[model samples]
Target: MAGNGGHLTPGLVNTRTHLFQAGLRGIGEGLGLLAWLSAVGEEAARLTPERAYATAAAAAAEALRSGTTTLVEHMWPHPSSEVHDAVLRALKDSDVRAVLCRGVADRADPSRRWGFDPRLMQPLEAALAHTDELIAQARGSRVDVGVAVPNPRCLTPKGMGAVRAYAEGRATLARHGVGVSYNPLSNMRLGSGIAPVPEMLEAGLSVGLGVDRAASNDTQDILEALRIGAYLQRAVHRKADLFGFPEMFAMAAGGANRMLGIEENPDGGVRAGTRADLVLHRFDRDHACLPVRDPGATLLTCGSSRTVAAVLVGGEVLVRDGEHVRLPSREPAAGLARRGSCGG
Candidate 1:
């Protein structure tokens, strides 16, 4: 019999991440959300298209290597078209499946109240036009362009109205169809109050997990987000098992597909005719070897990116033996500039 060295599971779908923040980690460690904004927002404002491209490359490589086969990147806008192009190029060059959400903040006035730079805001019309252009360019590509309203409060009523109108016309680009990436940890870390996950889920909306800004979470690991998300809810409700493995696993695995507006795969993930996104973790060794009594419990409590041994997406082996095998190169964005924006 051929022996398998690890546990096979669905490859995680990270619902949200600001890949550009990968380069801005640990900037405002002890500051609250407001103060952190002034420090970090300044860095965000200074990002050039070239820098954004480099950051996306570093982030894409990190996510793929860590067993995340599908990533939903919520990008903050840089004034340059090249920055957005850089992201597409990185994703294409890396060959990691992704949904690139173009985040827009039409009104930085509210952000200004928090001491953030006003320069970070893009005009509402320009933002929509850009998103439309990107979506048209992304047609038939693995990358999909979606609209992201970074913060509802950040926009004026007029700006909000504009977003609503633009979103209606671009309904196909909504996250997972009719869904939103909830980032409770990032919110709490910034003292931004917990996201209304319970409320949103109850309203019949498809809610998915997200790590939000890399600088906020300080790591791109989805296991950390899943565990922390469950813990926070439990602590809030005063119940030890307010959430369970099945719910969290679904969010990390097939939840995004709900928003993709695709039909459910009833044959099971490993069965024929189903999508081939999967991951293997080496649970037979080290810390992950704590116990196999309950696979879900073991996974949530002990698993981290370090335990990842392999990953497969759409039947392609992108990671093998804990190493990224299918990336364009070990170095980030090697010769990627020549590709010129990946068509979107």
Candidate 2:
């Protein structure tokens, strides 16, 4: 007997992802960070508008099945407006609560530079205009809008300041200070130095977990990321207890919820008034739980995706008995890939 087992709690929130990149996983193997970015960026640039819709739809389904009720998707630099529409349609149809971070890569003025495919760049002004259009339309939708800037090293000080200003504007509307969700695993994989998460958290900046793009992370498993995050930090600090299972769990679940402005109970999370995003995990029979003492600890160190049993958002069961509730497809958005150099 497996001991009639399962446990329920607040659902996990993936604070950052690039759902459209699900189709491009594992292409950058054996490549250095910059080389990988260029190679993958070029391939991502080749995605057509139709392909974007399909990829986003598939990613949403995967997230739901993995017990993620809320996701913050950092969109790629989409060329077609119809592609953006398709993304929104997918989220709405999937019933996943989300924050859509609009991607911007400017390439008109050589002074405003990033190390990405110039082919995908749009004029900064035009990009902002398009962003505004999307944000305006996102009102009353399940999706909210934020800005995704080129990496700091890819921009001038002035350009970085401009990106901050844009992000701050969204902060005002969201009623929370602008904070960043980051992917340490992807950063290390790409030779990007680890973000100063502890320092930022100490300084009161909201930091959350991100699985990044599929090509970058190769998978969208937030729980696995959670375990890696703790181990990575502990190893970096050369301290056995630097980031324990509890802290990382808080980061992926409650900590992320806080950054998104989701309310929490003093007792912990998911009260009557708060959004009802939650996950259930079963570990009784799994070898990972053989000698389980602390469930959270066992989950962090021993569990895998198979541990997840159920997921819910806003009190609606999205996954039950370990299966996703299939949603009917809606009208597809226009297109996914574009081939122009516009800048904002």
Model 2, span 1-344: residue lDDT tens: 12256666676778888887776667678788666766666666566666766667767767776667778887766566777777777777777888877777654333223444666666666666788887887888667777775565544566567766776676533455656676877877777777777777788776677777767787777777777787877778788887676667667775655556555322335567677788777875366566768777887887666777667788777766555675422321212223231110
Model 1 TM-score (2 dp)? 0.84
Report the error of model 1 at residue 231, Å.
Answer: 1.9
Tens-digit lDDT string for candidate 1 (1-344) = 11275678877777889887777777788798677877766777667677677778777777876667788887775566667777887777667788887767656553456222567666768777887788777777667777666666667788778887776675564433467676766877777776666777788777677777778987777878888888888888788877688777777676656675433432214555767877888776456457677878877777777777777878777777656675533455452333222221
CA error at residue 21 for candidate 2, angstroms: 1.2
Best by TM-score: 1
lDDT of 2: 0.68
Lowest-scoring 10 consecutive residues by lDDT in candidate 2?
335-344
User: What value does the lDDT take at residue 292 in candidate 2?
Assistant: 69
